[model samples]
Target: MSSTQLFRVSGISLLLGALISLIAVLLSFFVNPSFTAPPATFQSPLWSTHYSLFFTALALTLIGLPALYVRQRGQRGDRLGFFGLLFIALGTFLALGMAGYFISVLPMVAAKAPQILKATLTETSFSIFPLGGTLFATIGTILLGIVVLRAKVFPSLVGILLLAWAVLNLLGFALQSGLLAMLVALLSTLASAVAYGWVGMILVQQAGVSGEAAYQPQTALR
Candidate 1:
C-alpha cells in the first residue's frame, strides 16, 4: 500500500485505541478494586473487561508507533525515534504480559487460591511489572516527545502534551495511593490519549496529501 494509505490505517488504529483507552480510564473507578479490596474483586466481570480494553489499547498503540516513527525518521534520518519505539515496545510487551496474566490467571486465583492474590503475588511480579512498565513507558514517551519536537513533522503541541503526560505519570508513581495519585493517573492517561488522537486525526486528514508533503516540516500540522 501507499505511504498515505499506511498513515490512514495507522491513524485509525491510534484513534480507536485512544478512544477505547479513555473509556477504560473512566471505567476504572467503578470497575477496578482499591489497593485494599479483597481478592475476590478479580472475579468481577468488569475487571476483566477493563484490562481487556487496556490490552487492546496497548496493542494498537504499538502498531501505530511505527507510523509515527516513520514520519520522523523519513524527515530527519534520526535514530532517536527508533529508540523511542524500542522502549515503547518493551513497555507495551511487559504491560500486555501483565494484562494477559490478570485476564487469564486471576479469575482462577480468585476462585481457587484467593490468598495468592492477597499475599505473595502482589509483593512480587505484580509489583515489578507495573514499576517496569511505568519506567519504560515514561522514558519511551519522553524520547518520542523529544523526537517529535526536534523533527518538527507533527504539531509542537503533540510533543508538549506527550511530555506533560510522561511527567505526570512519573509523578504518580511517586505518590502513595490517594486522591492525588488517582487524579494524576486520570489526567496523564487523558493527555496521552488526546495526544495520540490528535495525531491520528491529522494523519487521516493528510492521507490524500502528496507524499512530498511528508518531507516538509510541520506540513501535517498545517
Candidate 2:
C-alpha cells in the first residue's frame, strides 16, 4: 500500500522476470534450430518448448518494465532512462510477435506446406520484426547503460557489461552469420537479465530504507 511496499513488489517482480528470462535463454541453447536446418527442424518438440519459454520470458519482461521505469524515473539521467524504456517496450512487443510465429505458424507450415520452407528461410527479411527489435533493444540497452553510469544507481560494471554486450551484438549482426548472431544475442540477453536483477536488488534495498524511514515517523506520531 505504501511507496516502500510498491517498490518491494516491483523489485521482486523484476527479479523473478529476470530469472524466467535466463531460463528461456538456457532453453534456446538446447532447442533452437540451425538456420540451415531442414524444414524438419520445426517438428521437434524441443523447438516448440523453446519458443514457449521465450513467450513466457517476453510476458514477464513486459510486466517488469513499468516497475523498472518507475524506479529509474526522476533519478539522474531520467530522460535517457525514459527513452530506454520506450525502446525496450517496442522491442519486447516485436519479439513477442516473432515468438508466437515460431511457436505456432512455423511448425504448422513445416508440417503441411513443406514446399514453402526454402522460400520462407530465404526471405529472412520478410520478417523484419526480430531484426528491428534487436536494433531497438541494442540501442536502448546502450543508452540505459550510459544512464546507469551517470546515475550511479546500479554498479558501474553493470553499465559497462551492457555496453559491451550491445557492441558484441552489433558485431554479430554486421558479420551476417545467423548462427553467430543468435549466439551473441543469447549471451547479451542473459547479461541483460543479470543487470535487471541487479537493479531489482537495488530497488529492494531502497524499499527497506524507505520502510524504516516511514516506520520511524509513524512511531513518533504514536
Instruction: Give lDDT per model, in order.
Output: 0.81, 0.76
Q: Tens digit of lDDT per residue, candidate 2, span 74-177?
A: 88999998898788788778878877888888889899999987788567674577788779878887887898888876789878877887887677666543
Local accuracy of candidate 1 as per-residue lDDT tens digits, 1-222: 777988888889899899988887777777543434567678889888888998999898788778888767766537878888899889888888878887888788888987676775666657767778888988999999998898998998999999999999889878835677767878988999989998888887778574657658676568
- Alpha-carbon RMSD to native, per candidate: 5.3, 2.8
Each candidate structure's TM-score, on Cα atoms with residue i matched to residue i, is 0.87, 0.83
Global Cα lDDT for candidate 1: 0.81
Off by over 4 Å in 1: 33-36, 210-222
The TM-score of predicted model 1 comes to 0.87
Clashes of each: 0, 0
lDDT of 2: 0.76
